[model samples]
Target: MTFAFPVVPRYSEIDQQGVVFFGHYLTWCDEAFTAFQASVGYPYPEMIADGVDIQIVHASLDYGSSVHWGDLVELVVENEKVGTTSLTSRVSVRRRSRSDEGWSDAVTVQLVHVCVDASAFTKVPVPPRLVEGLAAARA
Candidate 1:
C-alpha cells in the first residue's frame, strides 16, 4: 500500500441492513485518492495550478464483505498503473476488528482518472513530475 486513510463508519451512512451503504465506498475511495495526491506533494489545487487535473473516467468495485456501522475502516491506496494520459488507482477497503486488531477485506475499487488540461478540461499528457511523484508514492 502506498498510503492509508482511516474513516469510521457513521450512523448517517448506515443502511437498513445496519451496514455501511454500498455507495459510500466510492466516496472513501475518492477521498483516499485526494490524500494520496497530497502525500505525493501534488495536491489537487497544486496540480490544477500547474495546468493539469484529473477526472474519473471509470470506476469498478468488488465486494468481499460489508462494513458495519461501528467498524474501523481504512482505505489502503496504491497507484496501480499509469497510461499516456490516464492513471488507475486501487483502493482496498479493509475493516479492522477492534477486539483482535485483525483486518478483513471489505471492498476493492479501481478508479481510473484521465489527465486533463486544467482550463480546457481536455485530454493532456501526464506530467513527468506527476509520474515521478506516483513512483515515489509507490515506494
Candidate 2:
C-alpha cells in the first residue's frame, strides 16, 4: 500500500526560473516519509525515545516534470522492500489537476535507510516495532 501526503509548494521553494528547485524534492520526500511513519505509529521522536534510529544512507531523485509555486503536489510513499537492517522507501510526487482533481506523476525519489542503535550509533537489526508497523502499513 502507498501513503499519500498532500503538499503545496511555497513561493520560496521555486527558483528564479519559475520551477521548483531540484533539492526541494528530497525535502518533500522526507516530509512524506515522516508522515508515513507517524501514521503507522512509529513517529521519529517516538523512535528515538525507543532507542531506535533510521539514517538515510542513500537518496536519489528523478524529476519527470517541473512544478511551479502554489502547485498542489501529492507525495506518495511506499515501503515494499524491508531488509534485516535497512528499508527502502520510494516516494513518487504527482501534480494535482486543478479541474479534475487527479494526479500526474512528476518526480520519483528513492531512499535507503539503515536502522541503528541510537545510543551507540551502530547498525542494528530492524526493530520489531518498526517491522510490524511497516507490515501493518503495507497491509
Candidate 3:
C-alpha cells in the first residue's frame, strides 16, 4: 500500500525546456513524504515539538519520462525498509490525468530518513507511533 499526495506542477518547477527540472523531483518527493506523515497525524512540527527529528540520510531518483507544467502529479510513497533508527521510503511520481483515471509512472525515488533526538542530534529508535502509523497506512 502507498500513500499518495496530489501535486500540481508549477511553472517555477519547470526548466527552460518546459519539462520539470530533475532536481525538483527530489523536493517533491520530500514534500509528499511530509504530507503523508501529516495525513497520519505526525507532521514534522509535531515531531520536532516532541523532541524527535528525522534527517535524510540518503536519496536517489530515476526518471522514466518528462513532466511539464500544468500536469497534475501524484506522489506515491511507501515504506521500503524500516530499521531501528532508520527507515527507507520509496516514492513515485506519475502524471495524473484530469479525468481521474489514475496515474502513469513518470519517476521513482528512494529515500532514507534517520530518526534522531532533537536536542542531541543522535540516532534514536524509530518512534512507536510512527511505526504503527506507517504500518496502518500501508495496510
Candidate 4:
C-alpha cells in the first residue's frame, strides 16, 4: 500500500542551479512520513502525548532526476518492513510535469524508524493501536 502526498517545491528548497538540493530530499521524506502518520490517525502530537516517539535510526536517499522549483511532486510512501519495534519506510518522489513525465522515480528513499519511550528514550514495541491504524489506512 502507498500513501501519496502532493508536494509543492519551494524556491528555498532549491540550490543555485535551480534544482532541489540533495539534502532537501530528506526533509521531503520526513514530511511525507508525518503526513502518512496523520492520515492513519496516528498524528505525531497524539503519539507524543501518549509518551511514544519514533526516531529515525537510519535513512538513505538516491536521486535519479532533478526537481526544480514550482514543480508539483507526488511523494509516495510505503512500508518496506515492519517489525516489533522498528519499521522501514520506502519513499518515492515523482515530478508531475510533462517534461519529467518519464521520471517516475525522481528520488527513492528508505528510512528506518524505531519506536521509543519519550522519557526514557528506550526502544519500545509499536503499540497495537498504531499497527491497527496503519492497517486501516492501507485498507
What's the lDDT for all of these models? 0.89, 0.88, 0.87, 0.86
- Candidate 1, run of 10 with poorest lDDT: 96-105
Local accuracy of candidate 4 as per-residue lDDT tens digits, 1-139: 5689888888888899989999888888999999998887889899999999999999988888888887779899987677999888899998866454554678999999999999999999997777887777667
- Ordered from best to worst lDDT, the candidate numbers read 1, 2, 3, 4
Candidate 1 ranges with C-alpha deviation above 4 Å: none
Per-residue lDDT of 94 in model 1: 92
What is the alpha-carbon RMSD of candidate 3 to the true structure? 2.0
Which parts of model 4 are misplaced by more than 4 Å?
98-103
| Per-residue lDDT of 18 in model 3 | 83
Misplaced by over 4 Å in model 3 are 97-102
Per-residue CA lDDT of candidate 1, range 1-139, in tens? 3588999888999999988888999988889899988888788888888999999999999999988877889999999998999999988999976674689888999999999998899999888788989988777
RMSD of each: 1.3, 1.5, 2.0, 1.7
> Which residue pairs collide in model 1, if any?
none
Most TM-score-accurate candidate: 1
Q: Give the clashing residue pairs of candidate 4, or none.
A: none
Which parts of model 2 are misplaced by more than 4 Å?
Answer: 97-101
- TM value for model 4: 0.90
lDDT of 2 by residue, 26-104 (tens): 8888888989999887888999998989889999888788887867788989996889999999888998646646678
- TM-scores, one per candidate: 0.94, 0.93, 0.90, 0.90
